[model samples]
Target: MQLEPDDSQSDRPVPSLAAPEFAAGDRVRMNALGRSRHPRYGERQAVVVRKVAANGWRVLFEGRTSLLTIHRDYLEKVEPV
Candidate 1:
């Protein structure tokens, strides 16, 4: 007797582009520098994990996970850090 094979896991399609919108608890990169309290004011590397306002976001800096509120003008999408 002969047996038949199955192929049921190769019919789904993958996404091409992602939607534009930053949410809380999301990891993102700093694009530009707008304003800050630090002496070294500028687009320093950081992560987005909180939403402060309609066009604002809270990010976590290197070596730490503390959320820091910042405006959208001070952020830019970047590769995972």
Candidate 2:
């Protein structure tokens, strides 16, 4: 049997904190302070590509792979190694 989702609770997305602005090529690290964090991508340094939302910025991490949209609060500026 399949279970149905609860309709009583609101399915609206919770709003996150506003993110700081970053220019292209700014190095940053993902802070482990929020929800939905992956161990493989844990607190890794990334480069800011652009802003996707008021509190979300599109970043390209060190792996030189896919881009991720992370909230500003979860990102901190980091210096190059």
Task: State which candidate has the highest TM-score.
Answer: 2
Candidate 2 residue spans exceeding 4 A from truth = 1-19, 34-36
Q: Each model's TM-score, in the order given?
A: 0.49, 0.63
lDDT of each: 0.57, 0.74
Report the lDDT tens digits of candidate 1 across residue range 1-81: 887655675432222244236765565655423433343535456767767656667788776657677656555566564
Give per-candidate clash totals.
Answer: 2, 0
Candidate 2 residue pairs that clash: none
Cα deviation at 42, candidate 1, in Å, is: 4.7
RMSD of 2: 6.6
Q: Which digits, one per residue and each the tens of the lDDT, describe model 2 over residues 1-81?
A: 999988776643345455456888899886665334556767668899988867788999897788988778777788667
Candidate 2: residue 43 Cα off by (Å)? 3.8
